[model samples]
Target chain A: MALGLALALLALVLALVLAVAWRGTGLALGPADWAAVRFSLVQAGLSALVSTVLAIPVARALARRRFPGRGALITLMGAPFLLPAVVAVLGLLAIFGRSGLLNRGLEALGLPTVSIYGLHGVVLAHVFLNLPLAVRMILQGWLAIPSERLRLAGSLGFGPSEVFRHLEAPMLREVLPGALVVIMVVCLTSFAVVLTLGGGPAATTIELAIYQAVRFDFDLGRAAGLAGVQLAIGGVAALAAWGLYRPTGFGAGLDRRLEVAAPAGWRLWGDGLVLGAVTLFLTLPLLAVLLRGLPGLAELPAQVLPAALRSVLVALVSTVIATALALTLALESARRPRGLIEAAVTLPLATSGLVLGTGLFLLVQPLATPMVLALPVTVLVNTALSLPYLYRVLLPETRALQADYGRLAESLSLSGWSRLRWLVLPRLARPLGFGAGLAAALSMGDLGVIALFAGEGQATLPLVVGQLAGAYRMEAAAAAALLLVTLSFALFWAFDAGGRRAAA
Target chain B: MLQLDHLTHAQGDFRLTADWSANPGDRIAVIGPSGAGKSTLLAVIAGFLAPTGGAVRWKGHDLGPVAPGQRPVTILFQDQNLFPHLTVAQNLGLGLRPDLRLSPAEQARVEEALARVGLAGLGQRKPAQLSGGQAGRAALARALLRARPVLLLDEPFAALGPALRAEMLALVREVADQTGALVLMVTHDPEDARALGGETVFVGDGRANPPVETGTLLANPPQALQDYLGRK
Candidate 1:
């Protein structure tokens, strides 16, 4: 019955997206909307290409080289994805923005000044957001090459290239297509990054175009049309990606740290450079965000507290909803083993957030104003959005529990609530906490949906920060962004820490 | 009698068939080659896997519809017999009450079971804190507490040293003596089968034959059994 409710909710939400997207009588794609579509594909394609190609070396380097902080570095690879996109943009802008560190460095070097806006800036941020994920995926690919295979290569007098050809390349071939599709789809639905960094009309993504049609034009017809384009694009891509998306099992299992012969001489330096440069690219912006945001912290605006509290409430409630749905769906699917239910839960990952918000907007706008409906819509959409991550964390643990101890529990006469309480719940504690924490953090900083649903004075922390930035309140915006990051990270850290300690 | 009545289980290319029966307090060693039907027989009897044909009956009652936990059976695998995260008492407590919600008297029973297994002072310790033999003892304590009519040991101490395994078998023998359970054990070692003693069921070529006296079976083995023993 619980499973039915969660599944029904998932089905209805998806049905709503499809309904709204296809609701209008005619499908018209304007030049501007078409530009949005083209730009979305190009940037996502470029981002996917760059991140994957670059990830190969980093992953290869990580696979063979077991240095100090390697474990920490790998853990940190997962951190960037959890970063709220708004904070990441703020971080990136602090480094690559016009008056930022990179331009300053270039100025000092007597080189031409570069801007962190428009097409390249958008691509850069997308790559920044995605490269670590790519590296981690590809690194898992490299580490997955059994030591026995490398030993065989060594015994057969195969050099590095031979090993790469005979061993590494094939694994990469298997792993990359999935990684590319996933990253592109991720890039396709991107709102916060594109909205912030791609400041010009020429750089508008389909998602950004949806936001524009709703926010600026207030043209439901145009908005629905653009949303249809996004839905069609996102849906098709997501479907293809879903078929291909097997997560490269990075950071899973104890044996990720394997010993292999790294390449010699220049290859060594090349790998080192990739590792060094990627680290710098990832870390510098966060550092910049930190340094700039810190000075403005003491004078945070009075508006910060209420927004933060509201955001927290939304985050906490949405987390509970997401966690509940994830557990229910995961448990049911694991029990009955249904493919369709699993697919429905994850379908939101492929749908555009703006489109989802727009669909809900189309559904609710006539009955109630967007502002009154804003927080609830935000909560609902965030739950839908966060369900995938929750599933990712919980499903494996739940399935493994069933595999390893299901019989034991059954044989012990543990059934239903007894089995769940004694065996399943206790065993699932860590993943449950982690999943809840992920949902909390994601919802906390989610600037999606809220953009369309939020009326005047209904801004979330991310929305407010964006507004502050738009109004050129740079210091306050930086400070507010810092607060957002801190709150999100603290919530994640607390739940993650709580889980670890409980597991301990 | 604990009966395996014309049982058959087939998965892909592997098929296992068994027809065996044992009286109360019988010690039966199921001996077979590594990939043979030894454990499969025990699994069917314990209700972990359904048989392709016939039923398992205990004391003239068909055990087919019974869930694994509710059946007159207690089975232990080679290892991971206790969840590492749980205290020894809690792990043992599960055998008494699946919920581990023991009243004071029931808790005392858990303590008594622990003491009976030579783990009197170690009930508070987690599985990780216990040595291999001690962990095995904890598993035995749970099995003892449950006092199921049939005890199935799937080489539960196979990882233990020879001395420890012998000690575990001795404890199992004592537990079976107390509980009057039919002890069905799967072991590759001929010595273990001999040590278990009473009767032996030699499983190979997709069939588990009925038990004969262990000494008689070992002395005059079938061809498949002789080949397996010789190969080992």
Candidate 2:
């Protein structure tokens, strides 16, 4: 009953917002809107295509070859996908920004410096965050092609290129579209990467445009107008993707204990070099961020700690709300089995955080006691924003629980609270904890809600870091960024470890 | 102990209708071809499936409305019989009380059950650390701890070697005998039926044959059972 009420409320509010945005301010696609839309699509397309193309070789190598640190490498590939986006942006900036290490080294070498503040910068950051994700997804695809097939190819005296042509190419063809679509969806809703690296009109995305329309101009009409456009574009993409999407069991039992034949000659060297270079490119930026931030840590004072505390508190609240919402939605879907509602729960993935923040601002600002509801509203917005990821993490596990234990629990007369406590909760503990931890970490690193709703006294850690970065307080920003990363990692580690221990 | 009356369930084009009853302490092995709704029958009785037309009664009470976990029943699936992340002790303990807040005697009971399964002192090990036979034993230990009136097995040991399958089957029979629980198992192999030595329920064409003594059924097999087993 409570779940129904929550779902109704969510649906009603979302519907009302959509109606207002639709009728009150019909989508007026001006030249700026057109540019933003086109640029966003182009950028997302390029990011997806590049990420998918690059991930293919890496995924193939990881799937078909083995060596020392193979397990660690596979594990490492999963890390960047989970790392807080803002932290990744900060790390990338510390390495690739104008005054960052790369430019400095280039200057020393008497070469022209590269600017990490344009389309290329946006693409770089997108690739940096998403390449590993694409690789992991595609690697699971490669691994899914039964090892026996590959062994048969080997037994047939197939050379490396022929094997690649027959086995690897088909696998790539099958996996690439899905990986690209997922990446495209990710890039469509991107806010932090564009906000950080995308400078001037040339690189601006629809999400950033939404932020500017609301925060800078306070023009709800234009913001709403752009939001309509955003929704239409996103809705169309989502619909198309949904139509094309085959629900492949990407991660199920892919971790088979299998042996592979060793690569020979240049094949070995080439794979090794590609793997090493990609690893270096991905890890060096974070290392640079850590190194640059260490000296600046001394400059951070008591104020930063309280701001960090505030961030953690807000994150905790948002995480709990988001997890609860996700769990309720997952369980409800399991019971009721609505495909569209399940897809709608993931609609936030297509809507940018900046757009969400804009919607919240427009929704709340007209209220008489908006000030009193600020913190709760902020947390709620964060929860809604992080809802997609929480759903992604929880839904699979929830479905698995339903598949495995639903029968047993039903036979035993367990239902409602008792059933949840005895059967669902115990089995779902690990995934629930993981999802909650992910929500918390994502919320902690989020700057979107704070950008609009946060008062002078309401700054989160990400907001503080953004402020410092905007004001050219690079060192202080670095310190706060590092602190934020550490805090996020610590929260995730604690929750994950706790879940494991509880399961044990 | 359990009764299913005119149980009919249809999904897409497939339909299953079985009317069956089992007395307390009866062990019935359900044997059939793939897609013969052998597992589906167990699932319906276990309350996992709500039949389109039927009624289920357990212990002379209508079980149509009872949820699976609270219906004095337990199911052990093929391989996911034990939660992987949990230690053997924790898995056994969960069968007692999911919260693991057992009384001292209850804890002792779990420990004793673990020992009976030959998993004593290895209760701290996770499912990943266990061999195939050991995991099956651990699953049996969990069922022992549950002490439920009905034990449902969906080919839990079918993947194990013949020796191991026999050992697990014997262990299950032993445990069921001790608890006096009604056991309904689904299997594809005739050898499993021979080892189990229970009443046989052959399901085909969406209907289940009446329960027959295993030895007699094997010695003078019905045409349907012969056809199914021979095809396999």
Candidate 3:
């Protein structure tokens, strides 16, 4: 029944999005639209290349070296991946925006001041968000390298370069392509990041083009055409990436520190410098946001409180729906391995939120004002979007439960609600918490759907921050960005912490 | 009587046959060569697996089509006898109510069962808090509280020391004697078979021969039994 419900929901999204996309079918790409498409490819390709290449050194340093706070640092790496794009953009701008600390320092040093809003800024934000993801993914590959192989290398008196050639190179080769492809697909749907940084016609991405087509141009037909292009591009990438998502080795994966022999001299210094620089690059903007937002916390924008409340409500509602849906869908799929339903739940991974919102706009414009229904639609879409991660988290866990104790439970006559409450729920509390945390944080931090859905004064916090930053209200924008970051991390930490305590 | 009437189980190229019955309260230890159908035979009777061609009758009732829980039998696997996440009381209470919604009277019964297994005043502690031997006792307490007509033990205490195994077997014997429930325990340990002191079934070469008096079977062992015990 849950499978049926989940399939029905997925079918609804696909039907609506496709119907609108197919409403007026012509592959006409105007120069501006072509530029958007070309820019999307160029930026995503460059971002994927730079993030994966840069991650090699950081992940290598991490795998062979165990310093204090190393575990916490690795955990913190996940922050940017889940960090709301609007908040991250603001953080970057706090340091790299026109009068941000970077320009200020450059002026003091008599160097040319560099602005952050442009192609480089967009690429920089992409790398900042995805570099940690790539590092974590490649580090998992390095960790997966059997300790015996490293020991063999050491026994053969192989130094770092030889070791890389003999062992690490092949592992990286196997893992890097999938990581690059996944990040590329993710960036293809990039909207908020590009919207905040990439200004003017030339720098626009296909996703931002779709947004402009609907909002500025009011040309639903062109918007629908761009959406199809996005669907085709993102779908192909996602399909190619379907069977290759073994990064970071999440959820119950025990990544033990391997005792690979560390090289002395030049290599050690090089690794140290790499680690220090990467840490600063990743964390300084965040620190700036915190430092800047603290002063403005007292004199917050009058509208922030209500927007914060609205954001919370949206997150809470979406989290409940996603968790319930994941539990039920996971339970059903556990009994019978329904690959199609699993695929349907994860289909949103390939979707662009702007495309979906545009389709929804087209679907409803004739009947009702899209603005009036924005928040509810945002909640529903966010819930649907979150289903994939939550579903992935729950399915394997529920299957393991059934495998380990299904027979015992059956023989004990522990069926129906009793079986679920006693056996299933208690056993699943940890993954359940983690999945819920993922859902809540993702929903809280998601500026994409709300950007499309929110109308007039119904703006969510991320939207409000983006607006503030755009309007040059840096103090309030920083404060709001800080609030957005805090809300996301706090929700995640609470649920994750709750799960640990319960499981303990 | 719990009866296995010409039961046959097949998986891939392996097949096991059992034609055996034990009267109520009969204690039987199933012994076999490696990969023989000792556990398979028990599984067939426990309703975990269906026989290719046979019926398991408890008293006069055909238990072939019944679910494992609905059947008048309970089985303890090699591990996971108690849910580690559940408290000792909740683990024991599952025997009474799967929902764990115990009445005061049922609650008293759970406490008494806990005491009966030598785990008195430890019902609130979790399985992880208990020692290995104590966990075994807690599992036995649940089995005792379950009080089904038949109890199938699949080397549930194989990890325990020999002294502990003997003690557990003695406790199992006493519990079975008190409840008048038939017991079938599968063990690879030869001393466990002898110390268990029951009618023994020697399963080998795709067949489980009928249970015979333990002392007689050991005194003049069958070829397969000699092959197993002769290893010493």
**Chain A TM-scores in order:** 0.95, 0.92, 0.97
Kindly report which residue stretches of model 2 are placed more than 4 angstroms away from their true locations once superposed.
A1-6, A9-13, A16-20, A57-76, A82-94, A105-114, A239-273, A301-303, A332-336, A369-374, A414-422, B1-46, B54-63, B66-232
lDDT of 3 by residue, A1-504 (tens): 776877787787787677656763776878998888889999999999999999999998888776887777788778886798888888899888899898999999999999787789999999999999999899888888888887788788887779888898999889999899988988888778999999698699989988888878888888888888888788888887766776354522434756665777888898899999999998999999999898999999988989988998999899999898889888878877887677778778778678778778888888999999989878888888888888888888889988888888988999889998899878998888888988988888888767766787799998899889889998899999899989998998888788777777
True-vs-predicted CA distance for residue B176, candidate 3, Å? 1.3
Q: Reference contacts recovered by each candidate, as fractions?
A: 0.62, 0.44, 0.77
- Per residue, candidate 1 scores C-alpha lDDT tens digits across A384-431 of 888887887777777887778777777788877777777766788788
Show model 1 residue runs off by greater than 4 Å: A1-6, A60-75, A101-115, A148-171, A199-201, A246-276, A332-336, B219-232
Candidates 2 and 3 compared by DockQ, better number: 3
lDDT of 2: 0.78
Residue A40 miss distance in model 2 (angstroms): 2.0
The DockQ-derived docking category for candidate 1 is medium
Per-residue lDDT over B1-232 for candidate 3, one digit per residue giving the tens place of the 0 to 100 score = 8888887899999899888789988888888877898888888888888888888888868887899988888898888888889999999999989999999999999999989889999999999999889998988888888899899999999898988888999999888987888989998876777777778888899998999988898888877788887743
* Cα distance off (Å), candidate 1, residue A426: 3.6
Of 1 and 2, the candidate ranking higher by lDDT: 1
Q: Candidate 1 residues B149-228, lDDT tens each?
A: 89999998999999999998999999999999999999999899899878999888988889989999988888888898
Model 2, range B47-134, lDDT digits (tens) per residue? 7788888887886787878767777788887767766655788778777765666799988988899899998899889889999999
Per-candidate TM-scores read 0.91, 0.81, 0.94
| Candidate 3 TM-score to native | 0.94
